[model samples]
Target: MAGTSTFMEVVKAAAKQGSAACDSVAIRADQKSYSYQQLVSSAVNISRFLSSEDLNSSAGNGHLNGACVGIIAKPSAEFVAGILGTWLSGGVAVPLALSYPEAELLHVLKDSDVSIILSTEDYHELMQNVAAKSSAKCSLIPSVPVGRTEAEKAPLENFHSSHERGEEDPALIVYTSGTTGKPKGAVHTHKSISAQVRTLTDAWEYTSSDHIHVHGLFNALLAPLYAGSTVEFMTKFSVRGIWQRWCESYHEGIKADDAITVFTGVPTMYTRLIQGYEAMGTDLQAASASAARNLRLMMCGSSALPYPVMQRWEAITGHRLLERYGMTEFVMAISNPLKGERRGGTVGKPFPGVEVKILEDESGNDAPGVGELCIRSPSLFKEYWKLPEVTRESFIEGGFFKTGDAVRVDEDGYYLIMGRTSADIMKVGGYKLSALEIEAILLEANKDYGEVVCAIIVPEEEAKRKCAEELKPAITLDELCTWAKDKLAPYKLPTRLFLWDSLPRNAMGKDEVVIKAKILGSKLKQNFDIPSEQEASNP
Candidate 1:
């Protein structure tokens, strides 16, 4: 591609010089190590196959020329190869989350108009059906074989050199969680993706020395790879497995080659980890804490980090979780400084080279300090795929994308996200309140109640035991109101309370607050004689 270098360029350049680090381990998954050389070789072979007449008659000269290639695989070497191969064939790669249901998966496949679907053998049956339903061809991505002899090597062809695809050409299309509505495909060009990876690498100070333990795909995997760092993948987030892995990494004061130096997860993961720690024995706690504290960096994102959770995690691990802010539209545009104080309940400053504004209201007025957070970044997505009208409405006159998040600058110039304007913002008795702020306080209160507010799934027997064990009565609306009187205004108190073993969450671990609100609204009207919106706002 012209005017900018893709990540593949850096990989190829390092390979050309026969750099030892370039051939070092790139991905560690399922007790297997995939080297950079093997990754590139597999990608090249896949690119050749994609261009062959066997795949499609339209694929002349083996170049995708920006066609869409749907990639379906778990976090593994084959997934990496699929993405690289798509780029090598000049095709746009769209990573379909495995957690999506059949209908949603089919929606995305058809929406993106994917020309081909590449997946591993495990998912061949499912993907073939999806491909058939979406009118796309399907193929199994070959395993990336290790051990390449020098005689078998050749000068790698620059995939974009022949195709007229430029830096602005579409390279990736990632769909959002679609909690509120149908998922929209966020289109990211090569330049935008490079900018995001570079920003994250610089912000997190990623290097070859860092071994990242990734719980999810996307930024976690791609950023480390771009920085030439080793990535250890955990297909599923197991609290026990994570703690055990850290202990094994630093066993007997000996740091292994695969020692985890960095780890990132959502707030729920941290919350679970804290619960797991509390359940450990005294001796086990000491060892787990020591091992976790030894890690160079521990980060959290994808949702707000509760202050109580942060404090408890720091007390246990001696590492204050580095919290950052991002969305599917733009990978990460703001982050707390790696070497500075990470304030709890705040998502630090705008990232370098990113501009932010506050759109206060419908008139596009800029509030003194609080409003909807608008962002213009080099890493911003090109457009929402095939939704030009929606995409056009998403941006302002000067290209700042409306984030739909209400935020304000603290006295120290840090950004504090109030909450999402749609769901988190609530009007009560002529006053506006932030549900997230109240939820944080409620979460902290749960700790004081001396009973863990586990996911509502605890068995009835366990619930009875917990309630009986705690000397205090169960927390009630009145009790919460009394507790919060000092911290919040009268209108900010939660008028209703629904205690559950666990809050419902999407695949990303974010609370399905909007949907829950609708369910709650219906129940409130039927059982509690709750006033309508207009009535509530009046008096």
Candidate 2:
């Protein structure tokens, strides 16, 4: 990888081609397109400003020279430019999520030791306050110029080329999702960035016409840009907008010029999309289904995809979501192949050049086929920022990052991630159980006839609606157990259910509190926030 083209080099090459193909769109945001030339020009301007500020600082280097820069912007040309400018000036880029609350935002700014904050105008005031708290300077990221005439273009000077820095030089620091644990900054080197984009570009067959976005930074913008593909930004997730976009993609058997060819998302997104689909009328449903079917591919990850959601989506759209697995430590490693049979409930084999192993239990005892999943991949992050001991402890023998996930391989070699060792694996009546496995199965089904399974309950909208109409609980302990009898063992099914009005959740949408309670013998209990006067049996 030392001699291979860096991520910047790949992007720059694409930008150069934009000189002749001036209309070649690089990014689409806010209902407008920005060409690659505009991106490069804007990045160069930011790089110059950053360089001059460093030169003016008596003790600072001539350029950023590995200083950390915090970027805050919606998915747009401005965001891309900020990162590029940081790289061109020999700095590390830390992207701050727009969803973060004030306290969480403060934590990231302080944790990353950010020297400067570059944000869009929308967040200028907020970023200014946060940057001051962290003793970092805040600046407005320049808006990238679009559709500039050839004569109006200014030459870029002193821009660092791909060869200026080795692939191992640190490039990006993306924080962990914090779904299972505390968020940590996982630093990725230029080489790792290059590896990920190339790995994804090849694995998914990303072309100039296609658009993808499961991993927005990598899959949508960076990787697609490297492959000279146009990136259309959906800054916010809108059910109606997404469905309308798909419908607009193909109409009357003709592909729209801006039709999306490929897309990726999390399991929650797929579930939402399915909800959106089911809510559509018959004529609109037919159009959406047809458009989605014609798309080159659709994929899901970031959590276990419920079996029923997958089944229903396939029944409607004929696309079996290519579920994959990865984390902040590594952008992506294992996935169901694009062309092969997508096995349900499995996150297919490791990508080419990626290696993985399932480790034995921590108690010096083998647990048959199930164990912690460890990964070693070219795209693996360099380290957890500022946490030497934690970083060292994260990996095991042979440089493998010991992912705390529990997983088992199926007969066909596909990996099924059970869940995090501490967060997901459960010992119920001395039997090992996977909460994720149980959830994927349980979320797909439930029936009621006065009998029940008292599991952790988050009844679906449909269930609630039915209960409202019938004036009876939609699910009971006996009904759940009976339905799950063949799908899950007795020990795996929850004996107690907590049906809260609405559980508090963290930014990553993980439950924050369980509201622990004693389980009395099976008896009828008042439903929490039920739309109807329904009765449910509880343990």
Candidate 3:
């Protein structure tokens, strides 16, 4: 278990532990519970299905290695089965998000070079069209078998051994959000997956006794399942669903039977949850807070968690939410201590076996203060599929991957994520201000603004819009200046503001401020009353 191994090893180990002791709940979806045995059996069936389809095209020639299988099933027992089955058959599993439209789905399938597409009944039509367009075969996931009576049960004498998958073999191909350009596939070897699972399990103390209600996809799901925790999937992330689930978990007493012990979500989800709690009546708020308090852990990541939101959540739930930092390249590297002070603004120290450094700009050296974040970890992705040049440029002289994020270490050793070095780090009047920091302040000042985004506005465009339609600032310039006067330094306040109906978001739901800035700059030139040539050239 300490060495590098394939994901199927987890399934095999659970199977070898005997049906009774290891026969616990694995996945709960659509009100149906799937036992561990049932999950493994379904994986076996999926393996047979792939064999029948000649996915390997190697009847008796040799084992199937490096073959890619695209999985488009909803988060259910079938999804788990597809992944395990792909591993068992010595194939790479590429989990496609259902949120993707047809064009996006086709792009991923063709890019990954999938030989077969595995999907549930709900996605059959869409996936079938995608497979046809991509010239790939589509297969329906086998139904999980059940209802074997006690009298007919056989002794646990012999069972099929797990697939012989080496640690260095590729196991997963996850695509990036395509925020910068086209999405590129990120390859993760079996060893990397194993390392991430071990790190998360050790850090979070995931055990058979724990049941986590998960709202995220990919790494969040795989890492938890690999550690043998029961994952209850809520296909849709409804605020009502989450609160009701928490209430039901503790309806009886302090000691809950089916209580969810762990929870993880993005910052936006937590923000919405906080809003939901605020809207609740006094009696309902008490119940929601108490139920949430009984949970063992609540983790936030994938984006900067606003300090004000973090403070409000602590006030309501009496639990300090653990904040962490991670990306698609490396599942998770930095996390607040499970048993120590969970800081509000800082993402805690690096996990074991992970080394982090900040590379300064002008000095091109490791500095004590703010700089680019570089990470060297065993859990890092092997490469970006089919992008050798891009992959080569992503790392330093050593094996450290440049995270493209700007960060600084505080006196207490907790790392504060300024934001993405390329976008969120804004240069204003010779001073650098973190957009995330300003957004946090703005959110605190104006709760009515559902989403607040800060970007460097083109002054010329503001002048044009102001003259053309008699446009007014969404938040008065004077008001912002006054509100932020004490909270932030003068250099950090927005000298120029761009008001919009909404911020443009990338595929991953992240605001693309860099692109927005360029677009707005062009519009500013068209709209603003141009200054004289000398003035324009000077400023």
Candidate 4:
């Protein structure tokens, strides 16, 4: 049969190129390395195991159709194998996070309607219970054996030759982080995945020579692998582990083939890495900085990257951290360019082939200036799972996905993400204030505030004690005033401040400040005996 040439086909092709040419490392987990061929063989073996169990069969049918396989494994070679195996068996790969609670796990399994669960030994017990509750069969992903003999090896054949998959066929179903309400599954098709992989590979210039120290899960790992780059998994986010790995790559006597050249992380991860760098002794800091400087690229996203944090990071590492904006709906749409001037405060231009426009209020017209950022991209998701009305309402007149983010473009044509239009924009005395802007200023004032969330606290509450407890800012009222006095205008600044241990966030890592404000606003008015809007406006 002719070679099945696609993203998965690339893996098979790499395998046929022999142990030396395909001699590249595929995964680095627990300080050990696994090669590309091993990954392929493991995936094949996993597929065989699934076939043997007839897990893919429905009502005793021998053939496996498009069964959903729930993969509950840590980021490792096994996890990769499980995903590829599912794909090879014509099954849907559902990547489950280890961070999910049992209830959350059950919810995802139930929603995806997974037929079977393939998990690592660490998660065997947990998944067993989840599978029982969801009525899905469970199995342990067998470890790939080393040193395959001729007799043990099956004849190399094109498994995907019979089935031709289009780009729009669903390849993965990734759940949102679920910081606020219930988490929703966002589906990405083969084409979108291919587009994203190509975009990232072209943008970052990922090559076989590049060893990417991937800090996040699923998309981050798969994208690099799809681009034919080596991916080292950091299952746990450890500042020391990351810095030490970078240093080892550059250190003497340890001239390893696997040198981490690319790094991508969330805002929180970067902030922690900076803090960790600060805590190190001067000599270690110098070495760490030098090692990090040698890395080809470092990118940040998933949340707004504070300007202060970006500035500090550049000063310390000698590399300007490239900040971009994206959501789960589309893996990525806008990015700060890899070669050009990457602005610290802005998320740069639209990605290649992506079209963006800002829509104005009242008129609902495509205004040239500032308003809600709407996106039209080939990579945009099909729809929210099961939410037909939401799916219908999310698009604009031109089929552009309404981003729900308020944004503007600078003279340089860089896109600046103001914040989420609904939750991050606050109305104060007829003026609109950006909560992200205020939060950025607050981060600058005291980096120790860590995860900062700014919201409008409306006035009125029945219980004074409860109101006081819920409506206080993390920083003292005096401190907040002193901090904002110089940075913001009288109207742009937040009048009401409420602080808690942390802010409520939704699945996409967005804070639900609007909902909080509505609750707090009602309480504040009642407590202060303030007049209603009608009374206040009339009087």
Off by over 4 Å in 3: 1-6, 17-21, 58-62, 145-163, 217-219, 363-367, 448-474, 500-509, 512-539
Output the number of the lDDT-best candidate.
1
The segments of candidate 2 whose C-alpha lies over 4 angstroms from its true place after superposition are 17-22, 55-61, 149-152, 155-164, 178-182, 213-215, 362-367, 446-454, 457-473, 501-539
Model 2 lDDT tens row, 302-365:
6667677788889989998898888778978999999988999999989999998888776644
Each candidate's lDDT (Cα)?
0.75, 0.72, 0.72, 0.70
Better of 2 and 4 by lDDT: 2
What is the lDDT, from 0 to 100, of the residue 230 in candidate 2? 81
Structural similarity to truth (TM-score) of each candidate: 0.90, 0.87, 0.88, 0.85
Model 1 global lDDT (CA atoms, 0 to 1): 0.75
Ranking by lDDT: 1, 2, 3, 4
Q: Over the stretch 1-539, how does candidate 3's per-residue lDDT look in tens digits?
A: 22534456775566444544256777878878777766776676576566556666653433456788999887788898898888776788999987787888888888888999988998998888888888788988876654543421333224343343578878899887765655789999888888888788889888777788886554456666766778888787889899999999988446566688888887667778988988899999999998998899888877677676688778888778898888878888999999999988889999999998778888444345888889999899999998899999999978899988889888988998876665555444545556656666655665542555343322322221111011223667677778778988876665556566566554344544445545555655654343322222100
- Model 3 lDDT, residue 146, Cα: 49
Clashing pairs in 1: 51-62, 454-501, 455-501, 455-502, 456-501, 456-502
lDDT of 1 at 169: 89
What is candidate 1's lDDT per residue for 1-539, written digit by digit as tens?
A: 67655676766554443676657788888878877777777787787777772343465676677788889988888999898888877788999889888899899989998888998999999999878888788999998776675622655553334543578889999998776467889999888888888888888888888899986555688778877888998888898999999999998668988899999998778888888999999999999998998899999998888787799889999999998888878889888889987888889998999999888766434356878889999999999999999999989979999888888789997888877775455454544555566666656665632232321111121110001111123777677678878887765555555554444577777765554445455544544323233222100
lDDT of 4 by residue, 45-112 (tens): 77766666676456243234556788988778888889888776656688998879999999889888
Give the range where candidate 4 is weakest over 10 consecutive residues by summed lDDT: 462-471
| lDDT of model 3, residue 244 | 92
